[model samples]
Every structure is written in structure tokens, then in C-alpha cells.
Target: MYRVWGFITNYSLLLILGAVIALIWANVDSHSYHTFVEFPIAEHFFIGEMHEGHRMLTLHYLVNDLLMALFFAIAAKEVWEAVILKQGSLRGKKAATPLVATAGGMLGPIAVYLVLAMILGSDTFDAVKNGWAVPTATDIAFSYLVGRVVFGAGHPAVRFLLLLAIADDAAGLVILAIFYPTGDLAVQWLLLSIAAAVAVFVLANWLPRKLDKGRELRPNSTWVRNTLGFWPYLIAGCISWYGFMRAGIHPALGLLPIVPTIPHADRAFGIFAEAEKHLTDLLNDIEHKLKTPVEVILFFFGLLNAGVEFNAIGDPTWLVLAGLIIGKPLGILLMGAFAAHVLRLGLPEGMRTSDLFVIGCVAAIGFTVSLFIAAVAFEPDAMLGDTPVQAAAKMGALFSFGAAIISIVMGKLFGVKKVEG
Candidate 1:
């Protein structure tokens, strides 16, 4: 029993369990679930008052908008450490393939979604058209889980999938920040956000130097460096998040700009040259510290957001389903193949060209970020002004579960053996 508990807690079983409970609760008593999520925690009206004084936020808003910022931050850390801080990240032919594959993975789904939506020629398709970015996200956790089962824990294919997912996530972040907005752009607020990000960068660089000044005074104490390092980053991150929110952008993107500002230790290999390091860069310390809390956040995230009504299914559902399960793999494979031929890039050791398909299939599991994009894409009070359209896009996100199952089956068919480590 202890071993079982350890395994579940260690491997994000709590998060999966939370999602399951959400689905069941949503199906069994959706009104109660909706009420729970909508229940307001607090509210505040500014002295001048805009939009009813920012009404603190419901449980749903808190989870999706605020808490998810950390999730995006963690992902951003991975991308920054790999593509930016790492040596030889963009210089080599070996690094070029996955970068190209990431591009294909993103564009492929958008193309599939647009083409299918155009062919459908329905008013509903037109209403939810912004949802093209929904399926473009690849959920790293679920895909990695599937990949471990199919390719063994140490397979190069699994590593390839991780890199692909990371790159896809970076693409998704750009889409979320650029494509979705709650209102007209507030240029001043956007500039403020940029300033806040720069402030974070400056602080990140400056704090280490300041702490070093005290290091000689308290030669034996690690406390000075550790305590000062974290709080300033947190404060700066909060300022940055607020700037994005006021800028009329999704606050989740707030973390991206600031991530590159965080100090990263120099590394010798390309981003994909070594295995995905769980804890290598100093900039990643924030993500490492928040690992367990992030899991909890993801739990509530799933609970609050995964409760879409199945009856809301529409043409967007099929479009999303096809775009993810079919479009993701097709795009990744084709683009990867193209890069290999055009650039003379090669696959990772022990990974074949055929393995790319299975990797793509596993990459199709677009659960968390996909749902977040769906929420933004078919947001309420948008120009369309159709509540059902939002629900329909969410249904598309919910349907991504089918894609997970298909990936597992596809892996087996593609001869990816489950070798125990």
C-alpha cells in the first residue's frame, strides 16, 4: 500500500485522478461542478473602477488564469534552457531536424484545422474558427507517459518526443499570446509588461552579484544566496503577470518573456544533444521548487476546466479530433523527413525514420495546453457571442483523450516494443 501510494504521488497520479474525478463529476452532476468552479473567492473594486472592480475571480478563473502561469513558466524554463542557454543549440545539423519538426508539428495542425473548417462550410465552423490553435499544443506529461510505455524509459524516440513537445509548446505559447486577447490591446500595459520582464532580467543578474558581496561575510551560510534569489524572482514574476493581464493578453504568456531573463548556467551540449535535464540550469530552480505545487495546480486546473458537456459537440469537434490525431503526426513526420533530406540532418541514435510516426502519434496527446487554448479561442463575450461555441471548442479539447488512446494503439501497430528498463 505504501509503495502504491509512493508511485502514484511520485508520477502525477494525483493529477490524473483529479482529471478523472472532474470528468465523472461533470457527467454525473455538472451543475454542481459548474457552481463549485464559479463560486467567487474574493473581489476588489479599484478606486476608479474598471470592469466592476476586477471581481477577485472565481475558482475557475484563479486556476486557469493565475495558477496556470506557473505551468507555462515551467515549460518556458525548459525551452529557454534548451534553445537559448545551451551551447550549439542552433548551430549543428543534428539540432536542426527537431527544430524543423517542431515547426511542421505546429503548422500541420493549423492547416488541417483550416482546411477542414473551410470544407465543412457551416456557420458553426465560422463561429469557432479561432480555435485552430487549440490542437496545436502538445501536452508534455501525457505524451511522455505514453512514450515511456511504448519506447521504454530510455529510448531515443522518447527523448525525441520530449524535444518535439517542448518546441511545440514554445510555438503554442506564441500563438496564445498573439492570437488570443480579452479586449483591445493596451499598448501602455504591454510596454509595462516588457519593462517588468526587463526588470526581472536585471534583478536576476544583479541579485547574484549582490548575494556574492555577502558571501564573503557569511562564508559558511548558503542561506543568504538561497533566500534572496527566490523572493525577488517571485516579486518580479508577479509584476510581469499583472502587466500581461492588464495588457489585455492572456496572463499565462507573462512568464515567457521573463524566463529568458533568468540566469542560466552555461552548458556544453546542444539542447537535444543530451537527455532532457530535470535540473541543470539555475534558471530552472523556480520550476524545480514548484514541482509538487505545480502538480497540485494542474490537478485543480483539470478539475475546473475539464468539465465540458459532451452534448456541446459540434463540427469543431471533428475538426479538432482530426487536427490533433491525424494532423500532428502527419506534420511532424513530413517536416522531419523534409529536414533530413534538405539539410542532411540525422535522427538520434537507435531511432529510425519510421519511429517518427510513433513519436508523432504520442505527441498527439494535446490535453492541458490544448484546453487552455480552446478556452481562449472560443472565449465567452468574444465577437461571436455564442456560449455554445465555447462549449463546442472545449468538447474538442475533451475529445483529445481519444487521440491518446489512438497513439498507444498506433505505437503498438508501428512495432514500438515496451522494453522494461
Candidate 2:
């Protein structure tokens, strides 16, 4: 079974599975299930031995707010590596297609939403305006997985689409930061950002000093034998997250300052490349131990919370879901095909117009980013309580899932295959 999907198995499907379980649990009449989602988990730990330790702590926080920040950070890592260091980096004209798609996808949703708002009148239609920007996205991890499965290596066009999808995600993140950050921006928090930037720069300079003599950062020569490369940055990331949290900027925003300094091999020379390979291995181990757990735990608990009752799917929510799941695919495919044809950019390799439509359908798996948008959509001071907007977002994600299923069916019916680059 794992062989069938490969690692696409993770990402959104895992979260979606949890949600389905929650819905099923909701439909059931079991009282035992109530305690899990309802009862909050309050856990904390000491950093040192009983003699000298500080309490690292937690409480009833929103999963989307904190843990998902880490996901954003991790997702940011992938996109950053691409745009900054990888071949996919879009400087100037290279960014055209994804940039176009990003703008259109986001704006289209707002247009649809505003039309709904006007039809329903401001009060009713505007309830989820924060979510207006929700649909302008394509989840990269999931999209890459889907592309790998449906589009083989021969398909350069589809492969490019996958890259475009990832690039679009990065753009979406920027959009979220610019348009979606709630309320007045805080100066002191921005100051903390500057401080964090300074601290990371200081750390990067100190990396070589911590190394041994006769050893350069090049391959076969390792500078991190002294624990300077990975552990220090990982701990810094934790501290950075905490500080950003307290400083009132979204904690995930703090990740931007620390990455330029992650100590990946900078020298393109051969000896340095070998040493860089070894250092990279060490860094990977460290990231797995430190960062991966942060992301994983956050996801698990987030899922546990989602263990809430799902049977309550009502008319308003279901309709919103329908719009997201159904409307999004239709809107994206029609728009994308027109763009491709009008511009004379060919279809992704091994892909046809039908395939692009299917890809658009699957793009709506809006689990991660959509969830974040939902959490922020309603004003904390609003009347219907903390959840109406959240419910709408969840519905939209569900609708997206449904649309993806339809896309898969369509693809199978039409025979979408991998085309060589």
C-alpha cells in the first residue's frame, strides 16, 4: 500500500485522514470519543537535569496558530531552497507562469467571494473575507507527490508545473504575510526581527572559529566536528520561535532570519563539495532530530484536536465547501487552459488539457494554509463565537478533497500519463 502512493502518503492526506476520523467519530454516538478532542492536553518539560533546568511549557493554544507555523517554516524551507539556491529559483522572467497563476488564483476567489457578498449583502457574504485569499494556492509537497505519480520523468512540462506549483506556494506565503497579518503591525516585534537577524549573522560568523585547525569547511574536511554547524542553529530556532511568539509577530515569521545561516556547503569546489556532503549529512541528522519532531508533534496534536464532531455539516458550510471543492477546479482549469493556449506555452509534457484540469482539481487540497486562513478569518471580537469562520474553511478544504477525487476519476477515464522533459 505504501508502495502505491510513495511518500505522497504524508502531507495533506495524513491530516485529511484525521479529519475523516473526526467526522466519523462525530457521526457515532460514543461518549468515549468526547474526552480526546474536548479534554485539552497541557504538557511541559524541563531542559536540564533536576539541578539546573528551565521549564519548557505549553497550554490550550490553537493548533493552526503555533504548530502550523512550524509547518509554514518547513514549507518555507523547501521553497526558499528552490528560489534562493535550487534550479527553480525564479529571478525576474523565470517567475512568470507561477506568478501569473498565483495572482489569478487568489484574485479569482476574491472576485467570486465579493460577488457572493454583494448578492447576499455585505453582512452575510463578508463573514469569511479573511478567507478570500484562501483559494489562491497550490500545496507543493502534495503537488510534487501527485506529479511524481501521475507524471513520469519524461514530462518536463508537468515537472515544470510541479515547480510552478511550489513557486506559487512561496508567492502565496508572501501574500499571506502582506495581506493577511491581522491588525496593526507592531514596531517592537519588527525590532525583534532585526535583532534575530543580527544574532543569526553573528552565529554564522562564529561557525568557522568553533572549528579545528588544518580543517577547512571543504569536503573530507569538516568544520562542524565541534557541534557548531547544526545543533546550535536548531536550538536557536526553538529560541527564535519562542521569542517571536512573545514579540507578537507570528512565530513562523522568525524562521526567515535563521535559514541563510543553516551552514549548507557554499563552496562549489570539489574538495569542499565532498566535505560539504559530509557536513550536509550531519546537518540532515540534526534537522531530523530537532526540526522534524517539532513539525510532527504539531501535526499529531493538531489532528487530535480535529477529532471534534464533524456530523454537524450544515447548509451554509456544505455550500461553501461545494464552492471550494467544485468551483475551484472548474475555475482553475478553465483559466489555466486559456492562459496556456493564449500565451502559446505548451501543455506540461505527457499532459493534455484534461490533465491540467485534473491537476487544478487536486490543487484544492487546501488543508494546511486554508486551515490557517480559517483561524484568522473571523475577528476575535465577532459575535458568532470563535468558530464560524473555521467551519467555513474546513468546509472549503473538504470541498477541495472532493474535487481532487473527481479529478483523479477524470484522469483515469481520460488516461493522463507522464511525458518526458
Candidate 3:
């Protein structure tokens, strides 16, 4: 319980605070709130939103496009560690069911969102179609907190839920990169990102190790680690970010190409594991250093993104909610059961099939990433019957908190017994 509270305070509380403030401010005085969000810091800046004939750096752009990259980088680090480390949770047959379940989790929301949009009529479908990815997000920190409350720490379902959430994050990143381009695509610029990654990996990571291969002290590697520290990777990350921005990819994901270029620990203790704080590897060190800043970035992120006027609620809102509340649980149950029973990928010991539905319910709280996807999925100016489609979709994401109550109720109704570690 202490750990759960700690994690929430560290990662979630500030975000919630920011969101609450935004909601109140927007409702109280929408013009002032929006003005603050779009306040221009600089014009003709190297990295900013394109406006008129020049680039303009706005408060919103700074938080969303630049600082948010660090947040996504941290997420990429966890995903990388989960896939690459020797004791990775996502490795081997142990992850088969969860991985398959993850697919269902994403597919189900997409299916639900699109089908409902179609049913609403083609004009509505065309307007809201791009936001299909919004409901597929599972806010990992909140979901884990809710999961612990519902199933206790020791429940196999808790671990299963974590695995599914992590996998869902990985998939979400891929979707963001591929489907949510920020501007007109320019494939050639991606070469710069690739070059930056390879150059840094070789010069800073691989070369030092290669030089110190036969040395007992590993002098060269130690020198690079101590003397150079994170500078090379930082420089590479900036270049990669510029590359991604020029390539029309969302710059928030730009740091991804650089995360893997940095050295990491041989094993991971999983995301949110207390043991991870003790690891001194460069990757973990960087993550630790960025933790507080990322928290603040998330605060600003929530502040800028979650400010939907209550009256903005419309078709997109209900569609996103339906996708999460209805689609997520059914998808997880059906696909999870199919994987466990039909595909011969067995559920973790002590995890009942019924637990999958509850995990799905918990996973339905897609606040953070869902808000981000909503922001990008539609133009801010896009409207549906006087309601901003983005705001309506964001309201749905915000309302996903309702899933927490639904999960607890379902847990009780399903006879899910708590298991304390």
C-alpha cells in the first residue's frame, strides 16, 4: 500500500492536480486558459510550431513536443529493458498469453470505436475516425495502482495486468509513430536520425567497450562513462529529435531512437520495481535524473491537454468511453481465454480466467496517453456540432477514471479474492 501510494504521488498526483486545475480554469474562463496554453514564447524559433511564414514557439509546443519527449524516452527505456534484458518479463513463453491479450486489448478498442463511429453515420465517422487510437491506451501507473487495490499485491492477475499494460505501451508507441505524423512526411530526413543513433552507439557505447576488451580495469569504457557521461547521448538525442521533427514524426517520440543507443543494466526489476532505484547503469541513472522533471512535464502536459469544457461532451466522448469501458473488458476476456484455452498458452498459476476481465476493466483508465492521442488525432479546430472533437475525446479519456469504480465492483462480483504479497 505504501509503495502504491508512493508511485501515485511520484507519477500521478501532480498530473491529476494539473488536470483538475485545467478543468476548473477552462470552465471558469476558457479564453484565458486557452490563451495561456497557446501563449507564444518566441517567433521564428528553430523548434516550434509552424505559424504563418515562420515557426512560433508556444507554451503548449514546449511541453508537448519537446519536454514530453523525455517522458516517452523513459517509457521507451522500460519497454526496451522489458524486451532486451535477460530476465525480461516479456520474454519467452511466459509472455505469450499476455502478448496475445495485449493485441486484443488494442484491437477491441479500435473495433468498438470505429464501429460505433460508423453507426453514427459517415459524416460523424469521417470526423472522429482518426481518434480510434485514443481508447486503446492504458494509463500504466493508474492501472497498476487500481489493480493492486482490486487484486492485492500477490495476485498473479496483478503481474499479468502489468505485463499487458507494458505491452500495450509498446504497441501504442508504434501506433503513434506510424499513424500520427505531425506534418507532411519526408522520408529522407529519417536518415539523419539513423545516422545520429548509429554514430553515438558506435562512438560512445560500442567503441569504448571494444577498446577495453582485454583490459582488466576496462579503462577506456570507464573513461567514456566517467569523462563523457551522458553528453554524447544527449547530443545524439537532440539531433535525432530534429531529424524526427523534420521527418514529420511526432517529436515527443523522437528520443526513442536514442534510448537504445545508451548502455543499460544486464537485467531489469520491471517497471515501478523499487529495486530499480539501486541500479547504477547509465540508462537507469538517466531515468532517475529525469524523474522529477518528467513529473513536472506531465503536470504541464495534463494542464494543457485535459482542459475540456463540460458542454463539449458529444459523440466522440461517448464513443471513446464505450470503447474503453465496454470494449476493453470484453476484448481481454475473449482473447485472453482464447490464448489460454485454445492456443495452449496457459494462464499464470493462481490466475483465474475471470481475473482477465477485471484486469481489462482496470486497464480501461487511459487518461494520460489517451489525452495525448486525442490531441494529435484531430486538429484543435475540428468540431462536431459545436463541440471540439479533441476536447470531447479528451473528456472521454478523463472520464475513464470511472473504470476504477467499475473494476472494484466487478472484482467483488466476480469473487476475486485479494492476495497480499
- Writing each residue's lDDT as its tens digit, candidate 2 over 62-110 gives 3544556556665665565556654434534445544454445555555
C-alpha local distance difference test of each model: 0.73, 0.52, 0.91
Candidate of highest TM-score: 3
- Once fitted onto the true fold, the runs of candidate 3 whose alpha carbons sit more than 4 angstroms away are 45-52, 382-387
What ordering of candidates by TM-score runs from best to worst?
A: 3, 1, 2
lDDT of 1 by residue, 277-350 (tens): 45455565665578688888888877777776677787888788788888889998999888877777878878
TM-score of each: 0.85, 0.74, 0.97
Q: Give the TM-score of candidate 3.
A: 0.97
> TM-score for model 2?
0.74
Residues 1-421, model 3: lDDT tens digits: 2366777888899999999999999999898888888888997545344554577677888999999999999999989988998889999999999999999899999999999999999999999999999999999999999999999999999999999999999999999999999988987888999999999999999999999998999999999999999999999999999999999999999999999999999988888888888999999999999989989998999898888899999999999999999999989999999999999999999999999999999999999999899989987641111137888899999999999999999999999999998
**lDDT ranking, best first:** 3, 1, 2
Question: Clashes in model 1: which pairs?
Answer: 43-56
User: Whole-model lDDT for model 1 versus the true structure?
Assistant: 0.73
